[model samples]
Target chain A: MVDVTAPPLSPTDRSTVRRHRDRQRADRAELHAVLDEALVAHVGRVVDGEPVVLPTLHARVGETLYLHGSSGAASLRGDEPVCVTVTIIDGLVYARRWFTQSANYRSAVVRGHARRVTDRDEALAAMRALVRQVAPGQEDHADPPSRKEMAATSIVALDLTEASVKARTGPPGDGDAVAAGDDRWAGVVGLATRVTGVTTCPALPEGTPVPAHVPTG
Target chain B: MVDVTAPPLSPTDRSTVRRHRDRQRADRAELHAVLDEALVAHVGRVVDGEPVVLPTLHARVGETLYLHGSSGAASLRGDEPVCVTVTIIDGLVYARRWFTQSANYRSAVVRGHARRVTDRDEALAAMRALVRQVAPGQEDHADPPSRKEMAATSIVALDLTEASVKARTGPPGDGDAVAAGDDRWAGVVGLATRVTGVTTCPALPEGTPVPAHVPTG
Candidate 1:
């Protein structure tokens, strides 16, 4: 989780929560929570006159969001306007009406210019944070990036200053229909990401055994 | 699944797959599979001179991808360039080196002009498909959209004509390290989305009985 002591999300013009404004979360901790939990972030950028969006591995390092990809990924360009968005789906809402059918999800949209990480120390720290963000203990277990590897990598940082956190939870909005003598079923079906299993490298001895840090099914 | 008979994905200049080009999938079924399994899509559009991306409920009907949201949502514009991207993370690759650590994910990036659905019949079908896309059987059990409800909703359709699918699978790339005198553990930690539970509406009578179509954990 990000530092809870940080201030609330900035009330910038672009920070206005879209869709159900009532569901907007004002706490900065809430913004960190959303960014911390989700794994893949969709990075959007304008290329020439067309819009390009791609999913990239992302992690939050304090107040900055780091997005990772190969050096060739066009969306990682420096000083370009970008939108990074992440969504964690909690469940499926089965409402009485098709129009009311929706998802229970916590999402964060961060809008800002991408600042390419050129400082070697900052880039290395961001890379470590990104790996730990996905698999917590692996940062210590895995080898740090070699000097040659770091030279070929590309990472861009976005300030978490201008962002919006919007979420939907609880029962369906049309639960009133059930209380109003309508027998139709309506509620939430919960969903979550679970570890299915673990497979050791085929090149290793068959009895190598899974590590304590790696999660298993 | 989309029709297996559908032609392969078009290879336009914009459709050229980005990042790890070797991971680009050529089959149209691959694109449909990625779109069908992922629950949320990041929709990006150029707002003013900047980019805005939001997570929206998206579904595929034949060659068109329909994104659903309230009419006030700005991304659901008519004939405007938009980018829709979906990602399904399969696992985490625990590689020997931080630079080699990667995610096993299937992602599809669709880019084109948004064609807002104005026809009532088209909108209704798109709505039905979108609901059913999330909860497979909910479309039949839930109430069909009312005339007034449909009027308040907005859906924009983008052709599947210009899109690219990229996927990474199998073991970690650094498996060779295991045979090269390095005993470090390295492989994949598999992941999947699962149903946790089903909660019936509280307003309904106690023991209301979840419908057979609803999944229970």
Candidate 2:
């Protein structure tokens, strides 16, 4: 659960929302909601003086955002300046004018220097948090990472202090002229991440049942 | 319709796939498929020497990718270097080992300098293409942008010649020991963007039929 009592998101020079300022949300709960619901985040950083963006699974434990990848990855090394962004497309907005057609979405951007987690205990906890994020109950079913496996991975944590959240919801914001026109249809088509079914491994037994945590449409 | 016969995707110095070389797809068809299926893209660029990533709608016509935003947007201004990434998460992979847990996704990263479109006709066409990309049949129903509306918008185009496509599909790539273990369940929970329903404007007349192109779950 997010601590809504925490301070509202402060706008820094870079974190200030210039485009679509109406959609910029200042509430910390909105930021937490976008981060907790996202399974993957695109992390951007300067690698060898060039910008690079990579998508990886992430977990938000309270105020800190944790990211993990192979230690050898170029983007995962050291305390480098990084920008983490998570976006969820909620629905497609259709308007009677081409300029007003858009999609409803929630996005959060965090800018900070990511510190590599070298402590043994902290890395273990971060790894567990990541697993519980994607697969809720599988953390108990799966075995913890071995010592060798833990050493091979790199966990980076970014403070969520300097972050910005922007969201657009509901139907299209069409003009009065377009909205009153009956010649065209204008509305919003809702979308969601539908978990259709589960596919077990071939080595599993023929009648192995799907886990309860696995979502099915 | 992607020209599968077009030349294969040639990686430039920056577009090279480094993290997971095994999942790097070289087929141009796969690249086009990923770009077409996506409705939103994260555009990354250096603003005041800090990396900023913004989510916006995108459209691909032939080999060029087009993105439009208000001229007031700081990220969309100028012909600066940019990286556009589109990712589609297909499923969640549950493994018996915590280290092997992952998600199945298809992603495309295009690195290049985006040129701002100033030609009136080209800008109008790009806007139409973008509207068609999100709501296919709605383009014919909606009215074109007025001269004042086009002046407020900025359309930027990025060539898809230099890009990288990475994808992971099927079940988890677990080790023999983990795969053979029957103590715990291991499988993939498939996911997709399921369009649930439509919500029309209150001003819409009674019985305004839903468009056929609108997806229904």
Candidate 3:
């Protein structure tokens, strides 16, 4: 097992416990499960007194969350501390009122020190792990990163020690104000993920077999 | 029909051109289609030197994109320039190399001035439009926001005057540099936006026919 530790999958003392509506169950199991289901997360950070939030690919191994970006990413430089938030919106909640409009989502926020991944071995491993996680059995199919290529990209690994996962599932909430009346059409708009048939590049010659993983729904 | 000028479907300036794979057609079309299909966008902005990105409901009426948040949102307070990025991950692009691992996503980055919606009538219309945009038949079902409630919330409308969209789709790029001799199972792990059956609130007594527009897909 990875030498990772998090608050008892619940709220932690060092963590900020917001309202239950905004907080997800803290258990590692819940966090890991959602992370595995999600393909990417919106990463947020501040740079030069400006905020830049980039959508990047990420993966979780044990208790460590890994993020990959081009070395040219302005916000990832070693000058300041960063707050990273990863959110996976599972579905959309379509309520009658504007205020009640929300999402059926699972999100994890980590406030921690961000450092460049200098160890090449660890970076390579992390990258490979992320690759496999995103697409199972992809590591072997992919050409390993060349040293020059590896240097061109940057990877940051943050411990999931001080993080909280908050989620709101099911229909819209039943606040006192909202509960007073029940005539409105309140429900969720299911967002289904669909994969088109294998699309081939025009440049590629004919006869390429579609990989088994790219299933058409 | 709604007297709302729909923002131009795509950006005009050459700067809106995608830098990475400049020739991909699906990338461009997907960007606009994704934004049009979804009702809410995760808006990212900075406040007081801290980066905060919130998943708020959004609407695109013609070229102008509008977003509304609570008056309490720290990021929505100031008029400073901000980068608003809207992203929709269509599918997961699983590749053969760890470095090539990426998501098939559509994203638009709009760099411009954000103006606060101070006019009460416009704010109310924008808020109603936003809700209706997300759940097409919702505005009529729910009670309108009371004056106090409207005052409690802050609705900001930002023009999509200058923006660029970048999109990546299909299978992972075949890394020509590393594709010579390596052979492993390579493909994309697809994701779908599924709409699970609706679970009515306990407050909503049984058997209220699921609203037609409230999709059960």
Candidate 4:
């Protein structure tokens, strides 16, 4: 519903960080990058005057983020304000001082009132996009959602008009005193989500090789 | 301050899931496992009447979750209600039908009003636990937080009373129709947080070997 096309990264009143403003990435491209790399997002919504955060799969189609869950899901049902966050932890920063220790990560937060997709055509397209984002090339291979399946699922579309992206990369920025002292090691241990192996279903005939598109390390 | 020691997983008014109740893990040990494996938590707080979620390093100390941030961080400053969620994406489930696709993940959510830890000793211990959780042996090598550093950091503790843990592992549970048709691969691609390498600080002396505890694939 919100038209945010190539808009400059302008922080809204809520998006501004009171601390660590240096780490805030105001570039719109940065927000897109974080959303693209993430397969799941933690969505926060107010339930009964209390905040509830739930993890769910998400996909970005242009300026809108589509989050799908069972139609019966209480959190995704109503048209309420929601905050979706995607975080990619890149590494752990080991600092010389305990207070300075931190994680190297790229995170994006989008705040908007979710609009449940009701148009059948739009819902199908959003579902396809979600499939493509999670497992590339599978949309064409897998059967499309049936009428019953479509009716049973709820897809909420959130516009990226108001969003914030913050990232901290590279080595730990030790303080002057810790940098001067050379008693211990100080660096980053790179962390990544690696596809260790592909597992075929037991129902599948034996020797069915994993498709090339399936990610495998 | 909530004493929820190994109580039965009674669904709080806000913690009940209307969809996919089978995925909910009721055991307290399951909650602890998810918290232990997670390095970061997406913390949600109501800021200016809008839900805001931020990613931060977190450590578990028995029944409490300690989240530290810059004392100046507006989101961490107040004793407002907060919801902290830890999610671990274990794999990507490839189902035969697009509608059945889901991620294999373990997620835990804790909802409570954050209590700012002003006690110097408790704050110090929390900081040390945080350091040890992220980079195990590094805590022994690194200097403790100085008085100024301690004063600059803010630690918020959330009790584990009203919490929910949900996990979905193993293969994709395709419907009867989808399972009967075996044209495409149907299983989960195991994903893991792999330590690709360690980037040591240039400040270190020449030829300083990477520490053994520093994770390396």
Task: List the DockQ of the predictions in order.
Answer: 0.81, 0.66, 0.37, 0.67
**Model 4, position B197: C-alpha lDDT score:** 83
The sequence of per-residue lDDT tens digits that candidate 1 reaches over residues B1-217 is 6555576774687687656778999898899999999899999889887888889989999889999845664546667998999999999999888988999999999988898899999999999999999998999999888888988888889999888899999998988787679998889999999999988878888787788888887
Kindly give the stretch of ten consecutive residues in candidate 4 chain A with the minimal lDDT sum. Answer: A175-184
Residue B85 lDDT (model 1): 94
TM-score of chain A of each: 0.94, 0.93, 0.82, 0.94
lDDT of 1 by residue, A138-203 (tens): 999999988889988888999987988999998889887865678988889999999999988888
Q: Candidate 1 lDDT (Cα, whole model)?
A: 0.87
DockQ preference between candidates 1 and 4, better one: 1
Model number with the top DockQ = 1
Once model 4 is optimally superposed onto the true structure by TM-score, how far is the C-alpha of residue B24 displaced, in angstroms?
A: 1.2
lDDT of 4 by residue, A1-217 (tens): 6435687664577677566788888788899989999988999887666677888888998899999855664667637799999999999998887877888999888998889899999899999989988899788877899999999888999999989888888777873543556657788899998998888776777777777778877
Clashing pairs in 2: none
TM-score of chain B of each: 0.94, 0.92, 0.80, 0.93
Per-residue lDDT over B79-153 for candidate 3, one digit per residue giving the tens place of the 0 to 100 score:
656556667777766565566767777777665567788888888888777877766777777667877778877
Q: State, as a TM-score between 0 and 1, how close model 1 is to the true structure.
A: 0.96
> Can you write out model 2's per-residue Cα lDDT over B1-217, one digit (the tens) per residue?
7655576775475676777789889888898999899888888888767777888899988888999755674668748788888999999999888898889999998888888888888788888889988889888888888887887788999989888899999887773654444546688899988887888865677688877876655
Model 4's chain A TM-score stands at: 0.94
